[model samples]
Target: MDQDGRDQNFSAASQVNGDHVEVVVTGEVDMSTADALFRAATPDGVHCATLDLSAVTFFDSAAIHAVIRLADRYPGALEVRPSPQVLRVLEISGLAGQPWLKPPS
Candidate 1:
């Protein structure tokens, strides 16, 4: 959680389900916090990664770029759960149709 009473800041916590890892992220993801986001998503021994950003309140281009880079680095191993805000950014950036960024149901 952040001092400003926002949803937890850009941090990742994980749980293992059989062979997969689900990384739930909450809070804002921006230029200043992209490294943390990247590191959290690319932990060791993770064969499958899901980034859940439903609680995220904000996202910037840096976050989007980081997501793209991470996906490119890991290819089929990465899944992104972007919040509506994050999804909007991807849609505006022309990245919504990317294979790694599936629309929320």
Candidate 2:
């Protein structure tokens, strides 16, 4: 699919609450959509305090890289709840137990 077409399969939204922002993401998370995920998770140069990816259906290494970069940018300041799909990729990458990652709620 074209970039626009691929983009349509993914979405990320950020909600600010007090001192932190919660970023919610859904749909396929591949190379084509990882950038958008990063942008939504980090707004105004601040990494989001929480990442909600429970609705993500297709997760890839690119998405893992994006998430890792986000965590690296803020260390313990970030927490992520991942979908099973995202979790699988994290497990394969040996990043599933990282402190910043949490099981889905």
Candidate 3:
């Protein structure tokens, strides 16, 4: 799909509470959608960012890198609520249970 088509299928929204921001993401998170997810999860000046990926259906290395970059930008400030698929990716990438990652319950 084209960029517009991919964007229409994948969406991210953030809700800020005090110094924390919860970013809710829905749809596939591949190379085409990773940037938008990263942007939504890593907003400027937010002390903490919580990425809610409960609705995410697919993800790849691009999505993993996006999360890694976000963690690099703000260490110990990112909480990730991963879907089962995303959780598998994180586990395989050796990012699960890291200080920067909050695995799904």
Candidate 4:
């Protein structure tokens, strides 16, 4: 929590599956917390990765930039599954249609 009494909950955890890695992210994501997101999104020696933002409640452009950086690290191997909140932002930013995003089922 910050001085504003808002729930500043933020967390990112990674799981390794063979050469692939899956990063699950949750909570509010803003500029102040984007760096940590980038760090958690990048796992060494993992060519393929999945960023599951389906639990995120809030996010901003900083999160978009973080995803971009992660794309740089993993290239074509990064997949992002965005929550409704995140999906709205990504759609607004024109990133929702990017190849890094997991196609809707």
Candidate 5:
């Protein structure tokens, strides 16, 4: 828990496994909440970060940018599990084929 809960529209829960960290993200992810997600993922010290966006109901470009920036900030260290809707956004934004995004398995 950080500051005012209502101010941050997204929430994250993290679990570490070996050299990876699974970060489950819930709620909307937009300009207003992207920073929170960034802060949450930046601290785990795990080389690999998996963002479970299955629970995410909404995602904006800012959110996508946040993910991309984090991936760029730590190349080969970020992965995203975006739902079909979110994936569509990423694809439309020309970021779908990036190696940081793991194919659903």
Candidate 6:
């Protein structure tokens, strides 16, 4: 865990698997919390970054921007599995259609 991971308001954990990394996120993600998501989404030399937002309970536009920033930073290496709440926001923000954002199965 990095310093950013220590944020008590938000919790993010990352696991590296070969060329890919999976980041699990929970709690609210807003302007104040998006930085943690951004830090968690960092590729850190991995070819792929997957954001597991299955536990996210709340999010805002900043959360959407955090995902977009990850996409811009990593190009086609970003994948997102958003929770129901996060999914609604992503859909409203139109980020759900991005090629980098994998649709929930």
Best by TM-score: 2
Worst 10 residues of 2 by lDDT: 1-10
RMSD of 1: 3.2
> TM-score of the candidate numbered 4?
0.86
Worst 10 residues of 1 by lDDT: 1-10
For model 3, how does the per-residue alpha-carbon lDDT over 1-105 read when each residue is reduced to its tens digit?
Answer: 564566666889998888788989998999988998888876667888888888888989999989888888778888788889888888888778778656655
Worst 10 residues of 4 by lDDT: 1-10
* Index of the highest-lDDT prediction: 2
Give the alpha carbon lDDT tens digit for every residue of 1-105 in model 6: 237654455788888888788999998888778887788767467878989998989889888888888888878888888888888887888767788765568
Q: Quote the positional error of residue 74 for candidate 4 in Å.
A: 1.5
- Of the two candidates 2 and 5, the one with more favorable TM-score, higher being better, is 2
The CA lDDT at 7 in model 6 is: 43
Model 6 worst lDDT window (10 residues): 1-10
Error of 1 at 23 (Å): 1.4
Candidate with the larger TM-score of 3 and 5: 3
By lDDT, the candidates rank as 2, 3, 4, 6, 5, 1
| Candidate ordering by TM-score (highest first) | 2, 3, 4, 6, 5, 1
Global CA lDDT of candidate 2, please? 0.84
- The sequence of per-residue lDDT tens digits that candidate 1 reaches over residues 1-105 is 467643345676777776567778787888777767787777676677788888888999888888888888678977887889989988999988877776778
How many clashes does the backbone of model 1 have?
0
lDDT of 4 by residue, 1-105 (tens): 688744469888888887888888899888877887887766677778898888989899888889888888888888899888888898889887789887457
Give candidate 6 regions above 4 Å deviation.
1-9
Screening candidate 4 with a backbone cut-off below 3 angstroms (N, C-alpha, C), the clashing residue pairs are none
Backbone-clash count (model 4): 0
Give me the runs in candidate 2 sitting further than 4 Å from their true place.
Answer: 1-6, 45-48
